[model samples]
Target: MDAKAWDERYAGTELVWSAEPNRFVAAETGDLPPGRALDLAAGEGRNSIWLAKQGWQVTAVDFSAAALAKGKLLADAQGASVEWITADLVTWTPKAEAYDLVLIAYLHLPEDEMQSVLAKAAHSLAPGGTFLLIGHDLANLTEGVGGPQDPSILHTPDKVSAALPGVNVTRAERVRRPVTVEGEPREAIDTLVRAVRA
Candidate 1:
């Protein structure tokens, strides 16, 4: 969806996503010491606000102005501070080697665009900085609960690994999360990549 579509989606009374940070994000980043962090495609600022409360100076970037505004309200309510930027990830350039932690969650795009975004995200990290990414695994389409059905936007561990260079990959795999499907518990597959810049 484009920025306008996203804005309309977020214009609804209900929050499209939960206010809490993504489970993978919390688990992967919980132990890291506070530092400058970037949350790319940060819809509604859930992760960004959570990072701020954890003491990380955070910058949340999203193309939707409505989403950013909602995020600001949430941040204000929590007494958390975040620098919000409205820009497209494809066009927005973060400072090279500036962030101590870089996070991209569920930012699905075509294979070529995905690679470009991932490359930029890797370059945004400082030496020894951590880069964490989470997205719907390609397997999720047939064997999982909820995610985009288009295969072009889905990702795999191998694809993510190839997009990231100069990093020591700590974890790169298809992981499972439990979700309720028609009141029956089932596992949803997701691609997880955690790396540290060398």
Candidate 2:
């Protein structure tokens, strides 16, 4: 969905996604000492706020204005300091080699666009900095559950790894998340990639 559609989705009073940070995001960055962090396509700034609580200086960027507005309120209420920006991820260029951690979660797009965004994000990382991406896997449509049906926009671990040409990929594979659907347990497959810039 585009920014306008996302705005309408976030227009309601209730939260669209959970207030907590993504499980993978927390797991990967937990052990690392807090530093400058950037979250691209940071809807509602859930992960960004969490990073702030963990003592990281965070910058959250998303295209949806309504989502960021809600995020600002949530950050304020939580007393977390974060810098929020509104911009298109495909064209938004972050400062080069300035971040200790750069995270891109569930930002599904076409293959070329995804590669472009990932490359830019990887480039923003300082040496030894972490770059993590988690998203609905391409195989999820056939093997897993609950994600975008469009095959073109789905992510693959290999694709994400390929995007960060020179980076050291520590992890690149499909991970499963357990969820309940109509009282029945199900697993959702997602692509996970964690790399370190050198």
Candidate 3:
């Protein structure tokens, strides 16, 4: 969606996503110590805010100004401080080896941009730092309930891991979780990748 389109979506409501951090996010990083983190495509800053609450310094980046504004407001209301940045990831030159933890959740992009973004995401991780990527699997469009309908854009764990050659992929798997949205039983098929910068 375009900036104006996203602005309109966020402009009308409180926020479509839940205020709490993603379940996968909590499960993966629960054992880690608080540290500097970067959340990419952080639409409403739910994960970023959760990191801040855990005593981690976080930077949340997104292209939509309206989303960032709501994220900031939510952060303030939660008594958490996180650096909010508005930038198009396609052109955003993220600093290499800058973050102890890098979070990328539901950041779907066109096929052409996927390789470059995945490479950039791996490059942005600090040595020994954790990189978490969660997205709707292409299989979800046909086999699962809800996600990006376009199959070309949906990603797989191997696809992401292959895009970043230097990073050591510690975990790559397709997982299923039940999501109940408005009393409807929906299953979300997500491709999750956890890597450590080598």
Candidate 4:
């Protein structure tokens, strides 16, 4: 969705996403010490805020102003600090080797666009810094509870690893995780890939 569409969606709702950090995001990044972090497509800053609470200096980037505003509000309520940027990830150029941790969670896109953005993310990582991605696996479209119906946008561990240059995958797997949304037996087949700059 474009910025305007996202803005409308955010404006129409009190919380577009949950206030808690993504389960994969927390599990994968928990071992790392707090430092400079970048959250791409940081809708409502859930993960960013959590990182901030752990003493990481966080920059949360998203295209929708409304979403950023909501993120700011949540941060304020939590007494956490995060730098918020409003820009399209497709066109945004992050500084090379500028972050200790770079995270992309559930930012599904077409193959070409996904490759471009993930490459930028990998390049933005500092040496020894970790780059983590968690997204709806292609299997989710046919087997999971809820996600974008478009197969072109679903991501896999191989595809995400393929997007990085000079990075070694420490962990890559297709995991079947339970999504405990109330009132339903919901689950998502998602890929978790963690790589580090070489």
Clashes of each: 0, 0, 0, 0
Better of 1 and 3 by lDDT: 1
Worst 10 residues of 3 by lDDT: 7-16
lDDT of 1 by residue, 79-165 (tens): 999999999998888999999999999999988888888999999999989999999999998999898989889999999988997
Question: Could you tell which candidate, 2 or 4, scores higher by lDDT?
Answer: 2
Model 4 lDDT tens row, 24-88: 89999999998899999998899999999999999999999999999999999999999999999
Q: If the candidates were sorted by their TM-score against the true structure, best first, what order would they fall in? A: 2, 1, 4, 3
Q: Model-by-model lDDT, in order? A: 0.94, 0.94, 0.89, 0.92
Error of 3 at 46 (Å): 0.5
> How do the candidates rank by lDDT, highest first?
1, 2, 4, 3
Q: Compared with the true structure, what per-residue lDDT tens digits does model 3 show for residues 163-190? A: 8757789999998879887899989899
State the local distance difference test value for candidate 3: 0.89
Q: List the residue pairs that clash in candidate 2.
A: none
Clashes of 2: 0
- Candidate 1 Cα outliers beyond 4 Å, as residue runs: none
Minimal lDDT window, size 10, model 1: 11-20
Per-model TM-score, in order, reads: 0.97, 0.98, 0.96, 0.96
